[model samples]
Target chain A: MQALTNRVKVLDQKPLTFKERLYLPAIFSGMLITFSHLFKKKATINYPEQKRPFSPVFRGLHILNRDEEGRERCTACGLCAVSCPAEAITMESAERQKGEEGLYREEKYAAKYEINMLRCIFCGLCEEACPKDAIYLTETFAPANYSRKSFIYGKPDLLIPDPTKEPEAFAKAQGGIKAHKEKVR
Target chain B: MTNHLNLLPYLSIDFALLFEKLLLIIVVVTGSLVVAMYTTYAERRIAGFLQDRRGPNRAGPFGILQPLADGLKLFMKEDIIPTSSSKWLFIMGPGLAMLTAVMTGAVIPWGSALKIGEKVVSLQIADINIGILFIFGVVSMGVYGIMIGGWASNNKFSLLAAIRGASQIISYELAMGLSLIALLMLTGSLSMKTIVEQQMQGGWGGFLGWNIIYQPLGFLLFLICAFAECNRTPFDLPEAENELNFGYHQEYSSMKLGFYLFAEYINMFISSTVMATLFFGGYDIPFVNEANLANHWGPNIVALLGTVCLLIKSFLFLFVFIWVRWTIPRFRYDQLMDLGWKKMIPLALANMVITGAIVLWLNK
Candidate 1:
């Protein structure tokens, strides 16, 4: 019975030496090893008080973006709805009225946009499919809610804050995503 | 006969002594419960630290209030007794377990006597003549609790677990007793106070005065047996969660379950205390003349210091108990039995004989 490889050694069945049989020395060494860990840095973070930093390109919840002039950029093209792997996005388009130039960037605008957060996998396919740079994945994820109805994020829930009126919230929602794109360019 | 009859009133139980003993009992019982409660918290905290994680820290500062929260939860839980089980025996199981666990503290000498006015009060609850034997008896009775609990549960797994627990205790008790016989031979007394006082004499090197210096093998054997007696890890096959589905207390719920768990921690505390008393010189402070301290300060202060020293020793033992639990994996059932019957028994016997021979030679 030749061995298949030199590395494959037979099991050692020899009787234990007095020291090995005693088991104290080995047990003490093991105890000392565990004792050393007492002084080492703990790996756990106190979760609520401290948070791990997210990467710049980290895709989380979907947000409907607005142009620099605070006009809605989405034209309800349905490309995002088609590309969304989870089929979470749905919207209704309405023609821009004669006096609504300041409200909408284009003639066709989304009157009602809804994303079912429960079905969303946050794969960022919708963001990639959008030609108007309207739908983007934000750094913040969806928070826990009581009901399924609450999880269905509507236009109000998904829209970025009007940048002109609330610059702080708009910048916070933007996070490092804009800076990440600028660095790449 | 008339003179003896006249002295009966004076001999009738001293009111002061009765009062002191009652106070001591209350202190001991309450202290044991508090320490046992904290031990559960400490176990989790220590386990967490070893594994590089934070344990329960939400209850209070450093999770000091965790045990209280746990106790409240257990209390609030609905008490359930199985329909098929023997209700009386099921109820008595945990009660007996707790009783036997706390009863071992009676003979342990916590410290020296305190001098108050003209009356000297011993710190121990009862300095019984056969203190070690009393501990053995109580510890053995602990098995009955588990046996009854398991048998009354009407579950086969619980019954099997109960049998394992009983047999393990019985098998290990032999080697444990054998190892202690050597220490008994050296001390020439079964009384715990006498053994402690003997160690306090500090012959030759002061630091080497403890019985552990004389009977290292005996101490090691006794320690292993103590682990078995407590049904801690490595000898915890009786409560092997995976195989036995929580073992003897499988059907127990609410405070009955809590009682079983509480009894385990109390048992660990008592075992640690006994190990400290027998091998580590109970309340004897090492490398310093306690008598000199008593002379300089007061007997009360010295007694307090002794009590603190004993507590420190017991805590160290408890830490080691927890440490070993987290470090070592449980042994296989056959391996556990083999270790108990074959390896431990022979080593214990040899240690006893060698100690006896050495004691004889030293006397010669």
Candidate 2:
């Protein structure tokens, strides 16, 4: 009757002898192990006070890229939205006016690109699928919210305040997209 | 050998004074709570010391603000009620742990009686005729809280752990209770105050008085039982992390979880104090006549100082509990049962018989 659970059942160990059952020595031994760990470096990291170094590949908040001239580079391409498995992305494409060609480098541009923060699985597929190299995910994880609706990251919100925060990253994003666009032209 | 001096006339009469028991009861319970809260802070500091890290320094100056920080954290947390749980029982689980933890201190003689302006006040809450039994009774009832909470959790692991815990505690309590029967026979009184007063203080030709000397085997058995009672390692199978996640409080969160954890440390503190009081002569010291101090400083000051000494001993015992907790490994369920029933019970029985025979031969 007792063996019905799906959980992994450990092997049954033999019982201790009467003297062996005198738990003092064994209990003392176990205490010694914990005491050793008491000297071991604690696994607990004070999250707020001490920030752990994140990996370069660490995907965090999604950002819409800006080109070398500090101009918004997203060209209303629906590729990111279409590729997102979580359906976290939403965008409204608008035609770029005659004077704004340098701003977008495309006739069609994204007027309102919003990613529902709640649905985002942080899968990075949107970043991967963006042909314009307009979207990239940063290593920022500070998006806890009281309401689900507040998580929707629109164009302005998704834009990074400072790509220069990671200089190497800014140059990389700019170089990759500029080359890709020049090749297309 | 030091002649048996009776301090009962002083203690019993002083305790018999009206309103004294009530005050004793209040101080012990409330004082135990304060001590219990601080014990947690001490445990953290010790663990930090062993690890070469300063623990909990963010709360206040050197984290003197830690306990208050903890209290505030608990208070501010969301009090969650599970839809599947028996709301009443869930609420009552930590409540039971807390209640049982504090209640046992009611009869502990923190100090001997001291005389005030016009009256004498005993430093204990109640020195009942069946004091040992009263402690046993209350201590036994504490298990119900865990049982109820675990059962109500609607979790198989909790239920199993609770059953394991309940069985282990019940079996060990028998041995713990029996081990004391020998001590009672020697003392001929159940009142804790009388028992402490009875100890031949280490005066009069190197008196080795505390029951720990007379009953070394009993002390061994009793300490093991105390460890098991507190659900500490290696007897901490009740909330075995490998099997039960976070044990009975697995589903609990926020302040509810805080209450469960806090109540456990409090139980440990109270149990250690009880062990200190029962076997180590409560608050009495060898060669230090509490009565002598009473004569000079008056009874009230004597009682106050004695109470402080008892607290120091209890705190030392509490440190041991924490020390042992970080020292031992948890026992498996079967191993726990085997130790309690097969080993502790028999050893306790044998010790009692040997003690009985020796007393008989000496008297004869």
Candidate 3:
């Protein structure tokens, strides 16, 4: 039984001395250590009142992107659904009708878009696979919900706020994306 | 002289004394309950700080209302009784535990007597002559609560934990009693009021008169045994969750479980008060002669201040208890038994002998 490597060192299995056996000194030292931690900075971020800043590249919940004109950017390409490792994404495409130019960005639009949030691994593969820049992972994590049915996010749940209608919400949702774009530039 | 059956004079009620004692009892009981509630909050907060984390702060500012919230939640929980358990004993366990816990407060002298217009009122609920012995007797009876609860639970783990709790308390009580005997030898009294009075009589501005000066060895032994008696960590084997689940209260639910938990905190509070009374000069304001203060200020103010001083000392002891709990891990069963039987008993015996010799020699 030779040493496997030079790094392998034997543990000291010697009997404890009288002082060590008393344990008072060790206990005192431990107490001092814990007492010192009383002044140390706490590692908690008070939820609701305080939040830790996420890195620019941090991936969280998925969000469907909208163009400057508040029209959907997705052209029903099905690239995100194909590339999704979790197969969380699903959609049904429909031809854009006349007088619906304000709603859809292209001739064909996603009529029914869904993401099974329970199945989502949150790896951002769908965002990576999209060629249209139609999907992005925002800095908002999924909130708790009671039913399994509630986790199946539909188009309305995934879609970002219309910039023209809710400027504040749209800006807040776009904060991480703006920072990410600046970092990339 | 009128008749042999004329016991009316002896049986005459002192209305003021009765009123004062009744008021004091109400105050002490409610005060200890409030202190116990806060102690739970403080324990959690201290544990958090020790581990470099912030404890509960959501219920109210700094989570001050956490104990109330916890109590409400426990009350709201469904009360579950095991079908196989003994109905009466299972119910009686927590009640007995709580009864013994609150009963220990009766003899503790909170402050010097307060002087009203024509009457003097003692702050103690009952200044029993054998105060220390009374505490010991009641504390020993506390074992029955655990024993009955564990046995009645009809679970093997609960029964084993109950036995451990009983034996632990018994073994530790010997050393605890022995250590207190050394203190008793110096004071020559069992009355807690007399012990504090003796401590307040000497030089060095009343601070040197504390019993801790004479019996450091005894104090150390007593403190260790106090922790054991309270079933605190390093001696908390009876409630070893990893091994015994919830111990004697395993089958308990709702307020029954709350009672057991509340009893533990109450035990900590009372032990802290006892340690203060026995060794740290209970209700004796250090560095100031209380008599002079009572003369200068009103007796009521002085009495209130003395009570405050005693509370401050006991709170420090409670902090030390929580601090030690967070610092040390639980002891092995064999190690616990070994410490109690071999180490504490011998050390306490030696302390008692040494203290007795010193006391006799000083008188000579």
The best candidate in terms of DockQ = 3
Q: CA lDDT of B34 in candidate 1?
A: 95
lDDT of 1 by residue, B1-364 (tens): 6997889788878788899999999999999999999999999999888888887888999999999999999999999999999999999999999999999999999998899899899999999889999999999999999999999999999999999999999999998999899999999999999999989887542357799998888999999999999999989999999999998889989999999999999999999999999999889888767888889998899888889999999999999999898888888889989999999999998998998898899999
Q: What are the clash counts of all predictions, listed in order?
A: 0, 9, 0
User: CA lDDT of A77 in candidate 2?
Assistant: 77
Worst 10 residues of 2 chain B by lDDT: B200-209
Residue runs of model 3 more than 4 Å from their true location after superposition? A1-9, B1-12
TM-score of candidate 3 versus the correct structure, residues matched by position: 0.95
Summing lDDT over every window of 10 consecutive residues in candidate 1 chain B, give the lowest-scoring window: B200-209
Q: Which ten residues in a row have the lowest lDDT in candidate 1 chain A?
A: A176-185
Return the TM-score for chain B, candidate 1: 0.96
Residue pairs of candidate 1 with colliding backbone atoms? none
TM-score of chain A of 1: 0.85
Instruction: Give candidate 2 misplaced runs (Cα > 4 Å).
Output: A1-185, B1-22, B200-207
Tens digit of per-residue lDDT, candidate 3, span B1-364: 7775697778889887788788988899999989998999999999999899898888898999999999999999999889999999999999999889888999999998877777888889888899999999999999999999899999999999999999999999999999899999999999999999999987765799999998898998899999999899879988999999888889999999988888899999999999999999899888998878878987899899999999999999999999999999999999999999999999889988988898899999
Clashing residue pairs, backbone N/CA/C < 3 A, model 2: A30-B327, A30-B328, A30-B329, A31-B327, A31-B328, A32-B327, B114-B299, B115-B299, B202-B286
Q: Which scores greater on DockQ, model 1 or model 2?
A: 1
Candidate order, TM-score descending:
3, 1, 2
